[model samples]
Target: MGELNQIPLKTDVLIVGGGCTGVGIFRDLALHGVDCLLIDAKDFASQTSSASSKMLHGGIRYLESFDFALVKEALHEKNLWLKLAPNLCQELPFYLPVYWESKYPFLWMTKVALKTYDFLSGFQNSAHKILRAKETILKLPGIKKEGLKGAGVYYDAIVDDAKLTLECLYDSLLEPNANAFNYTKIDKVEAFGDSYKAELTNTLTGEKNSIIAKKVVFATGPFSDDLLMNLGFSWKNRLLPTKGSHLWIRKNSLDIPYPLVLQTFDGRIIFVIPQRDAILVGTTEIQAKGDFFDLKCSEEEIDYLLKNLQEFFPAAGVSRKDILSTFAGIRPLVKKEGGNAHNTSREHQVFRPGKNLYVIFGGKYTTFRVMGREISSEIVHGFGGTYNPGTTLQALRQPSVFPTFTPWELSEQAVLESLSHEKVRTFSDLIHRRMGLLSLSNWNHKKSFVDFFTGMLDDMSRYIIVNKAEITKFWP
Candidate 1:
């Protein structure tokens, strides 16, 4: 829906893909006063970035693998964002309940883990505590009580993934000579002198144009493998495309009092997080089978999540009927020689196929800002600009119009303003990401979702095309 009237003839830097990594570098170079243009094949952060588990935290399970450095860096970033964007995300205490039959049974194992986790954060987190069996049951009333020995309480942040990435782009656009576009794709790329010539296309309108860029970076995330190879770059498959899916269940289905961490029989972990009006559950890891660009939650993954969830909370009686909606995404783990997707390191790799071309992929969502530092620094220095690493440490300047959480009003004035400024080109962009309506539930108590938008649809037509069918289907 984002149709650009004028295309750039040339730029100092051209970034392909507008996910976290892409936007991270975009903001970095923009802050250093370099001319940069970022373009995405679709809406920014609409793919794997939006489909994450939605938690910004150090991987607690990675400790078993002795990935201390990654865990430490992620913990620092986790706590930093909790300070940076208070409106976009919130910190919550995660309860990891341990049973007698568990591989790492309570008190000692959880005690040592929580101590190390707190130490990694330098005690910036809400202090981790090891609770006894009685205390665990008292705090988590709906948890499985059979053979429960104790629990480990730690802290992490829950974020609005799409909104966070969008805010990053907005912050970069506030800088001088900074630009970005969505629904724009690079159909082909060719070498040209010190710079490269990129053939860009408008995916929606089929418009075509070519531009010369001094430097090109592909921060395509999971789609990196397929994209670079298709664009005729000197590329090889470096990604292990793994599918992970989630289900949003009605809140009352589980009545969870706190966010939880559950370990499964298959050596994977499931996160049960409770958001306003819904219980967010998910993530079945398997080899990705279909199109990487578009992924849907498979029945097997859905059943897998519900089954593991039921095992942890047998009294809740959760099933497919309780699901409000479902979403799935792929994880672009850099393929290792012998390890599987679950065991691959959460670190990233930057590839330089040509003197001016860089390809980056395979990093945790929490470490995006740091992941692009090397590329941004090298690119900025190439343009004779002093890249200040501290610039990104500051809080983002632009925030989404709608507060991502619930208990917020939806107004015509706000929606119209967002449409004009937030790069919202479609109806779904406004309703899903900007407005933060993940499910079909009505926000206003006095009106149905459709009734609330009854007259608004006509006004919305002035900016983007819309009809009652779009509003009608959301309600009934």
Candidate 2:
């Protein structure tokens, strides 16, 4: 499955995009013992999919809209994720600090939401903890105390999104007939009889090739509409991309009395999540137009986030100077009639526009596996009574990194040690998304970190000398 420049290879399934959705499909198909080929226009997970808020929790906020099904599915999948990749996914306790001046001022109603979340999660992992106002202040001394009420604490999980995506791709590559190449773009796609043909070009090298497959799946997320249009389909309005931005600030001791879900002035929600030595304050949801790849935190967004951060933690030292990094990502949401981006539905869609063509639209990071299974089921049904869908369920427990290793056996530290400096670079790249070390260490990213990483790279250079600048460029 390596470099077929002149050869036109046939496959059972051809997937475009190496994002989470594409890799999820590949995992499902490979488990079913199918012939598949996955191609990405860039390195795997080097897009919006990997650049997520890194929360693997069931969206508790969705309960306000009574989206029980999405909540339930996400909650179940969250547990499955914990059991399958414990090395990468971890349970995190979050706090919801209440303010008397806020619209949702009633602590009782917040308790109701927390209890609902607990019920949805089967009351797992300290489902909800209600604390007095004084207790809340003790936990977060920086919190505004004037109109402060009690707080509701709950459990959710955070994950290393890039690590998970890479492991998924690695697992898929291990399967026979499953191959992935970065910088490969499916330029044009068309139905040929009952099958489909696509012209693929390497975006990096400008090399072109054609591939044919019985089934072709489009998992391009926000860019799905553009790709589908190239395939002669007019499926506009399938998704409206919503841009979300987050800022990473070097943590001070005063930053987190604990993980906080601070209330925004506009009734929106944001998490002041505490990493070991840093705090992540995120997420502004606005309808995004033009380019999805060209996402950066606007001055307006940074100001808005800072104002909100000041409202809750006035003396937390959260200025532009403390910011270590800033990132933005787009959520592929199904186009709705009229509402703010945050109010848009978070449900997923799987549809077939033609015989053997599948397109997945609209889903959150937490429910990817379930989405994969559902789409795989649809693909199996289109195979005309040949393929069995149950195999995917059997393969559900398989780890995307090391298939033989159970959740209990896989080690996060082991994975970190295994990476070369050529492989992992930047403080954020190493701890934040690759090793789960952000949660594990407060002593990360000191002068020692650069030296430690440099030492590792020097050792790796003996075997595979890589251009440090080239490899580290993508990290920051």
All candidates' lDDT scores? Answer: 0.85, 0.72
Candidate 1 weakest lDDT stretch, 10 residues: 438-447
* Model 2 weakest lDDT span, ten residues long: 401-410
**Model 1: per-residue Cα lDDT over 330-434, one tens digit each:** 888888999787888988899998898899988888999898777899987877778788888989888888877756776879888888889877777788888
- What are the C-alpha RMSDs, in order, of all predicted structures? 2.0, 4.7
Candidate 2 regions off by >4 Å? 1-8, 384-476
lDDT of 2 by residue, 1-476 (tens): 23333424778889887788888888887766677888877666767776677888888789989998898788877887787778677787798888888768999989888888889877655668888899988887788898888889998887767667767666655566666666688888877877888898877668888888998888888888777776678666678888888888777734474667877889988888776457788888988887676378888889988889877777765678767767788888988788568788889888788777788868888887777878776666666535554454432232332221122233433434534321232333444444443333334444554444555665545433344563344332
Q: Report the lDDT of model 1 for residue 105.
A: 69
